[model samples]
Structures are given as C-alpha cells and as structure tokens.
Target: MLTRKQMELLDFIRTRMGTDGVPPSFDEMKDALDLKSKSGIHRLITALEERGFIRRLAHRARAIEIVKLPEAMESGGFRPRLVAEAAPPPPPPRGALAIEPVHALELPVMGRIAAGVPIEAIAHVSHHVAVPGSMLSGKGQHYALEVKGDSMIEAGINDGDIVVIREQTTAENGDIVVALVEDSEATLKRFRRKGNMIALEAANPAYETRLLPDHAVKVQGRLVGLIRTY
Candidate 1:
C-alpha cells in the first residue's frame, strides 16, 4: 500500500505528464505537496520506485516513467503512457572508423516560464534536456524552459513546448524573451520599449500588454528555437 503523500505525488506526476508530456520539476512537486524541502520529495520517489510504481531514468534530469497505477487509479480507467526505449544502433561495419553523432547538445532545463501571468523567477536547474546544436544561436550560454501558458500561442508557442533560450541581458524590440519582472517573477513575452518604460506584450488578445518601468524589467534571455512533442 502507498502512503498518502506517495499517492498524491504519483497522481501529480501522472497528471502533469498527461498534460505536458513531461513530469513536474522537483520544486513544483515540493510546492504542490506543501513540503518544506525537496528532500521529502526525493524520499517519496524512492519509495514509489521501490514499490514498482515508477522508474527514474538514469543520467536524465527529471525523467520518470510510470510503471503502474494503484487499484483506485486503475478503477478510474487510467492508462499509463509508455515511453519507448531507443534501440541500440547496429555495430559499424568491420574495420570502419566509428563516428559520433553530431549536432545534439544537452542543455539544462531551468524550470517553467509563464506565458500568461508572470510567475516566480526560476533560478535553479531542474534537469537537462537534449537539444539540437543548430537550435542554439550565437550564444554565450543556452538553456531550456518548459512553457506554462497560452499567451504566446499566436507566436506559435504553446503550453508544454520546450523553448531554447540564448542567455543575454538585452533584447531588440519585438523579440520574444524571458523577462524577469521586479527581480522576483519571470515571464515569456515580446519586449517593447517606449521612452523609459518597457512593455511586455502578449500575443493572445485575452492578455493585456503590461507596461512597467524600464528598471523593473530585466531581459534574462531571448527565444531561439522551440521543440514540441505530440
């Protein structure tokens, strides 16, 4: 039998994966369960894994596979989604030099970025995701963020899409960027400047453009490329 916290965590993970095609980050789980620290989450995950409830992928950040559901969840007709394992490539021809695959690099997924209302600034690395090197722009450093809202839908950015960001402290007008608001909250929006004011514009008509003092906005990074999983 699973503990109450364990069941809650499992249900949360399954629900997030079903919605976003990715599991929630440790911080998110911590917040959802109202736990004081991530250590509690770690222990609960270990317990679930020991019970054959989930599998954590080695060397992958935040990668988890749901192995089975409890009887209660099963009666609800929940179907676990299985991630197919990639088969090993055939051995190179005898005497042929083996070449490593190119153009793919592992980038840290910092955390979720809000595309609608601004959320707390994400400063820690949650996990790493493999991104095509070509997706990176002329960058000093690059990172990935899971988008969390639909305000940028008109720009072709959707909730659950992974956005590749080139770290920078500046942006041109109309460029979509990760904007840190008041040094506390972060959002994904188009950047616009007028006089000494900065405008964070949302693509969707439902969201009004937020105009703030230039000093209140900081450009964390600019959007480079996006990846979406069906």
Candidate 2:
C-alpha cells in the first residue's frame, strides 16, 4: 500500500528511469513536483526506500531506480476482498484449458549422464516437466528443463531435478541463469556479465568453472521461482 504522495513519487521514479534509464537528482525531483523545499520529498523517499521499493546511493547524484511502478495507491488501490471478487480458477490441464501466464509446460526427463559424455539424448521422456508462471505479470509461454549435474549445489539445485526455465534474454547479477556456450551447447549456472569477460561460474567448488570470451556467451533466463517435492 502507498500513500497518495508516495504513489506520485513511484510514478515519478518509474517514468524517469523506465523511459530514460537514468534517475533524477533530489533537486530535479523537487522541481518536478514544484515543492518549495526538498525536505517533504526527502521524507517520502526515505519511507518508500525503507519499504523495499527503491534504492538510493548514500552520496551520489541521480540515485533512484524505480523498482515497482505504484500501480496501487491509498485512495484507489483498495481492492475488494469478496469471494465473488476472485478471478476464475485456472483451466484444466492440456487442450485449450484456461492457463495462467508462464505455466509449467510438461517436458521429458530424457537420459542419464556419465562424466565426459555428451549432454544426453531425449531417447524417451521418462517424465514431464512443470514450469511456473505469473498470471498477473508473466502472461507468456513457459517451459521446463531437467537438471543433469550438481554444479549449482550451493545454489540449492541438485542433480536429477526438474529445473523450470522461462525463456528470456536479459537478467541481473546473482540470478541463477541458463546460458548457451559457444552456440554449440547450453548449460545451467550463475551468470554475471560486465564488459568483455564472461564467467560461467559453478556454485560447488568440486566442479571446474568455465570462462568465456564475452562474445561466446548467451544468457537465456533468470531464476525467479521453484518447486520441489519429496
């Protein structure tokens, strides 16, 4: 929930950064709202920042990135909580059932692995895959993959597990990422790219990491949610 002024600030930050990729300074913010002093704006900004909405540099210019656009405000953001107000339940599985955005698409478990062997062949799909998707924001196609190795054990992904992969191109630092190596193959690892060097790092110390020239790496999608059951 956001106060009226906070919502305005949210809009201000998002409109500036989402369109321009740069944030505004305090003075700029003050001018945008036509306030007499920066204190009023500063107080609201501090509150929004504390609530996990924005990030600000301690002592730098242009230090605000719009994390979430203020879609809901105190005045009009109150959504009715009636049983009848709920959205219709998702459709049944397969064949034109109503599906949420980015759902777990069933895929095959393929084959087993031996060290120094090719990634594996989907000789027969031992099982199906289920990838999750967001109904509100991620209203797109979805798919899943099976984990083959323990390279990401530190990241809590283990061998012989179903790894949900939403197809995308851009991701942030520390996102458990799926990537393509040299256009020849694909692998799962934590991805971090800056400038020319690319590092496909493993979370477990037992596995050797792969370092690639920036041109050789292609980022696929970021990890946002997961599902596991015993």
Candidate 3:
C-alpha cells in the first residue's frame, strides 16, 4: 500500500517519464506537488525508492527509473486515461479567396520521425502542408515530419506535432536535428560531437543519450519550425 502523497508522486513520475523520456526535475516535482522545498521532494523520492517503486540512475542528474508500479493503482483503474476521440481535422483549404489572400509554401509531408527510439525512415511523400514562407528561413529544401514519440517533449516537441525541418548535412552543437544512424535508423535529438564520437541526446531524463562513431551519424536536417494542430 502507498500513501496518497506517494501515489501522487508515483503517478506524476510515470506520466512524465512516459511523455518526456525522462523523470521530472526536483523543481518540477516541487512545483507540481506544491512542496515548499526540495527537501520534501527528496523525502518522497526516498520513501518511494525504499519501497522498490523507483531507482535513481547513478551519475546522472535528475535521472530516475520506475522499477515497478503500485499494484493497487494498476489493478484498480486508478491511472488517468487519454481521450482517443479527437475531432476530425479541418479540411484543407481548396482555393484562395480574394477576401483572405494567403501566401504559403507547400512542403512535402515526410512519413514519420521517431522522437523516442531510432526507427527506419519511411521515405515516401504522404502529402503536403502549406506553411508560411517566413517560417522557412534556413537554406535547402524543407520537409515536414510527424513526430511519433515523446523523447523530445522537454524541448516542446510533442508526439503528433509536425516539425518543419531544413534539409542539411551539417548542424551546430546543441541544435535539435534529425539524425540518421548507420543509414538505417533515424531519430530527433540534440546533436553534439565529442572528440570522435557523435552523441544524440534526449531532453527527457528517461532516455539515455546515444553515442556513435563520428562517421556513423548523418544529419538529415535542423528543425526550423513547428505546427501543432489542436
């Protein structure tokens, strides 16, 4: 059995980790739990750890792993459920009206991009999205991808959000870029080069950073804009 506060903490951790690929920071937990200080958050974490609910990852700041779920919560339907029924997407405008002149550039809608784990890139044009030309500031052809996971949620890129990417083969440090690994898999993460290794880092605490040989990772594009539908 878990105390109400403990249950709340556990649920928060689970939801955050599930959606962000990392555990919530102490400040985030404090704010969410309405605690006065980090000490109170520490106490709650310690209690949960002592009961085998979560484990802290050594050498990683703000890192935590859910070891097990509370039996009662799982079996008693205590977890919150997501609403699956979304309103149908508004139909795309067919023709321009003289009253409301819209100037936009249509970009290919790439299949999908894994925001969590690296997945094979589905290289097919599904459709096209009309975006304001002002939003495409970078050079090279721009494409849009449907983000499929929450690994980049902490960076404000949520699952199902369409990200406009500027196609490029190079990126600066700390740029959130689409990276292809071994020519077979792709993921969206912050790009960094340390000595000879390339690291693709997630903004969330739940996912570990991926490191590879410098020649193994290819930069697909840099994220330049985003469009969230509802």
Candidate 4:
C-alpha cells in the first residue's frame, strides 16, 4: 500500500496531467503536499516510480507518467489530504466585488540562486508560477528563482521568496539583478559599476562585496517582483 503522502502525490500528478496534458513539476508537487523541501517531493516520486505507480521519461523535464493511481483516488473518494485535513475557507460575503478572471503568465522557476556565495547555474526549468500580466513590468521574457540566503534581507528580499526576474544582459546601477559571474556561477545582488570594475553588492553588511572586471560579469535579469507563499 502506498503511504498517505505517496497517495497524495500520485493523485496530484494524475489530476494535473489530466487537466494540462503535462506532468506537474517538482516545485508544484512540493506546494501541493505542503512539503518544506523539493527533496521530500523527490523521495515520494521515486517511491511511486519504484512501485510501478508512475514512469519518468528520460531526457525530459516534467515528464512523469502515471501508471497507476490509488484505489481511493480512482474511486473518486480521495480528496487531497492537504485540502481534506484543512478547514475550508470562509465564503466571501454577498455583494462583494466579483473577482474578474484575469489571464496568468507562467514563468519558469529555475533552480535556486544564492544571495551569498555564487552557485553553479542549473539550466532546467524545475517548476513554474502563474502571475497576472499586471504583476510584471516589461515585455522581456522572464524567469523565477528561489532565494537561498539572507544576504539581501536588508533590501526586504528574504530567504524562500520567489523572485520574478526580467531577462536582460545589462542592468542599470542600483538595480537588483541576477548576475552570472565568469559564465559559471550565478548570484543575486545589486548591480554596480565603479570605475573599471563591476561590483555585485550584497544588501546586508554581513557579506562583503565582490568586484570583478566588467567583462567577467554578465547581467542575467533585473528584479521584477516576488511571490511569497504563506
């Protein structure tokens, strides 16, 4: 028998693929189960794959295929545990402004970006978040990254916040940007040009500034906004 968590994950994958014709991403699975880490989602997925409940296609992103679903879900009796165990949200009062349906723009949430030490960039799109077009500013393509450190806490960007970034190769001074250093590592910092050097400045005093020649730094994107899940 599948554990409750495994059952929950399997149900989610089936439901999502049935709706969207694509398997949900790791981050989506994590959010669906109220999981604290993607590692937990990975473990659960591996268990399902091992049990013949799902198949992961090789050389693909979000390429999971559901082979079997729990009887509970198949019978239409399985409400997601995260939803079933939680209290229902109160209904909006009558005559409250009707919510207008707005189209959402889905952006890839790439792997985590460091706010301190630069980390090797992961090119795969792990998950995505849908934000209304109004939430974004420019016409440039955008992507999202999860902040992993408190190096920018002084600037109100905290660990665990998902930052929406506008793709660009150049940034103005004082703009918070995702910078690719030496074409290998990526970091989130304030962009600065001082004399002949390009500086990636941390918002918090605890971290020292990194200075390199202008050619060594590539501006990946500028901060657009952020999504923080409660």
Task: Give the candidate number with the greatest lDDT.
Answer: 1
Report the lDDT tens digits of candidate 3 across residue range 82-181.
2243455565568843343444677766678899999886554566677787888755567788999999989999999999888777899999998888
Per-residue lDDT of 1-230 in model 4, one digit per residue for the tens?
55445766887888898899998889899998777899989988888898898999999888888887655456553231111223444666898865554646777676689998898865445566776678778775677889999999999999999998887777899999998887668899999999889999999999999999998987878998999988
Would you give me the overall lDDT of model 4?
Answer: 0.80
- Evaluate residue 212 in candidate 1 and report its C-alpha lDDT on the 0 to 100 scale: 99
Clashing pairs in 2: 102-133, 104-130, 104-131, 107-129
lDDT (CA) per prediction: 0.84, 0.58, 0.80, 0.80
Candidate 3 segments exceeding 4 Å error: 1-102
For every candidate in turn, the CA RMSD to the true structure comes to 13.8, 16.6, 18.4, 12.9
lDDT of 1 by residue, 1-230 (tens): 55335766898999999999999999999998777899989988998999899999999998999999876555442222223436656789999988565557777676789999998876445566777777778846677899999999999999999998887778999999999887668999999999999999999999999999999998878999999999
In model 2, state the lDDT of residue 36.
76
Model 4 residue 146 CA deviation in Å: 1.0
What is the Cα-based lDDT of residue 79 in candidate 2? Answer: 22
- Residue pairs with clashing backbones, model 4: none
Better by TM-score, candidate 4 or 1: 4
Q: Rank the candidates by TM-score, best first.
A: 4, 1, 3, 2
Query: Candidates sorted by lDDT, descending order?
Result: 1, 3, 4, 2
Q: Any runs in candidate 2 off by more than 4 Å, and if so which? A: 1-127, 131-139
Please give the clash total of every predicted structure, in order: 0, 4, 3, 0
Least accurate stretch of 10 residues (summed lDDT) in model 1? Answer: 76-85
Q: List the residue pairs that clash in candidate 3.
A: 21-206, 22-205, 22-206
Which runs in model 1 stand beyond 4 Å of their true positions?
A: 1-100
